[model samples]
Target: MRKPRRGAVILLIVCLFFLPSCEAIDNDFSIWDKLFNPVWDGDFSSLNYKATYPENNVTSGGNMEAWLDIVGWFNMSRINGTDYIYGDPANQSITEYNAIDTLGWNDNMDWIKHELLYDVVNDTLIVQDNITMLWHHSEEKTTSEGHTYIQKTYYYSYLTVYDSEIIPKQYVYDGQNIEALITFYNNSINPKSVIFIPDKLGLYSIDYTYKNESVHEDLMTGYVENNSKGIEFVNFTYNSGWSDPGGNLSHIGVCAVVKGGNFTPDNLSIDIYTPYEQLNITNYNLSTCNLFKGERSMHILLFPILLIIFSPFLLIYFIYKRAGR
Candidate 1:
């Protein structure tokens, strides 16, 4: 075999250096967490807003208009055990208003189910509601069809008193919001093992065990031992029940949080399965330690710097190849 040329040897060395750096680029930055599991500052209180209505009188018999008026009236009125009262001028049972509400209701839904829970130990208040809504659209003059869609939206909200300050918050539309709240104290708890017991007649069960005895805030340090008998692990999401905000867990995943600060997931594993079959577990590992330590932006900037450093080497390799050819 002929000995390799000097240019070839240099090219090989450049590659050895370049490939590792490219791989290290990912490790150097917590790109997964930044993209998927973004760091939440745990300031959910901003989501809290008192229900309000327009000062102008609602005038119309259209379904959308009628439904809005009913909702506005319901908010303005006092709720009295299946009945609503708005200054004597309006007094109606929830059932009476359900008919008009259906006009704008999605999926032919006629009810709004609400659940509320209070945790004395944690000093937390949780409210969950399943509301069916009629999504409306205007008819296009060009198209022959009108547009309307019905949808059921689930909302999860929580309120807590920490350090004598009221912290009220709600989850964003994405599914991760509820999980953030439940595992808000994971880092602080720092449990060696977490066993999620399935509720009686429940849907799923989750268990987590840590391999390394020593805890490293920077590394993912555990394994998920899913020993569920019948319940299949779904997405990490909030319980829809109002009476138990943390109950009826659907999505099972892990989370990390800084006490009195923000919440971010280090890893999330989703298990998909049928009612009576083997489980399929999909894992998502998110690196967020750098984000918390304020190194994220610096790491992102390093990518361009690496390219700049290697650009000359890459150009030389191409030029040498052209001369040899």
Candidate 2:
């Protein structure tokens, strides 16, 4: 009887802890089964951290390690036309005007310029990107397969994501007719705001803020200075000054084609990075970009592909060498 009573209490606590996490996903549960499956789905695009922390006051069990449900989905196109919603239209944070091609998102800084101040007392740093996305104010299921294990599963929208919007002034979800903040135009920009900061301590922070307003604003404290120093204790951001060499290697400076030699760093840094909000893959369809990411054995096949492309030349050279012999 004591064991049974203890079990009930644990179960209730577990439910309350995970309930907020559920809000980020949709109804389907099959995708979750793949979470632990040994088989590779060949879709790294489908491979994402969970749907991310729910924005509308929901919490990730007080540890928002999955990042936050930090992006919004807007209908950038019309039913009669193609997806003007560029790239994967999945984790985008900026907005663009359909009319004017040049002067874009009238107030774009709201999304990128934020200071996630480090807490000296708590030894933590917390900040948010695109708080207006919460206005998008945002369900679940399960299946039987011999319940040998209990894993928390999350699913994403096959719809609904693109089906909603809550951009301020420029757009309101479901035609809500409102204005707020953040408007950026230019190539579906989803800049990693945290990356822009020079003194960022993201690699070291260990906890997330539990109770408070979700709009994160506080800069990383002074720690590392590259070629220059930022204001004292100010968390400065730095978008790479180098121009894109024409493709999607966001951190072009780290790539072999660009600045590829000793991959070791002179300072404390992360090699690859996406926007903190990019982990919020709520409306993103994972199927669209697997081949591009070189997942699904695309990297495995690259050798065969190159071998075939140059096989004829190799054969000719081989025959010429044999004839010479």
lDDT of 1 by residue, 143-261 (tens): 23665543345332222111111122221112221221232322322212122222212122222212211111111111111111211111121222211112122222332212332
RMSD, one per candidate, in order = 27.3, 30.9
Model 2: runs farther than 4 Å from truth?
1-231, 235-281, 288-325
What is the C-alpha local distance difference test score of each model?
0.27, 0.25
TM-score to native of every candidate shown = 0.16, 0.14
User: What's the alpha carbon RMSD for model 1?
Assistant: 27.3
Model 1 stretches with alpha carbons more than 4 Å out:
1-177, 181-301
Point to the candidate with the largest lDDT. 1
Q: Model 2 over residues 82-132: C-alpha lDDT tens digits? A: 112322333333221111111123211111121222111232122332211
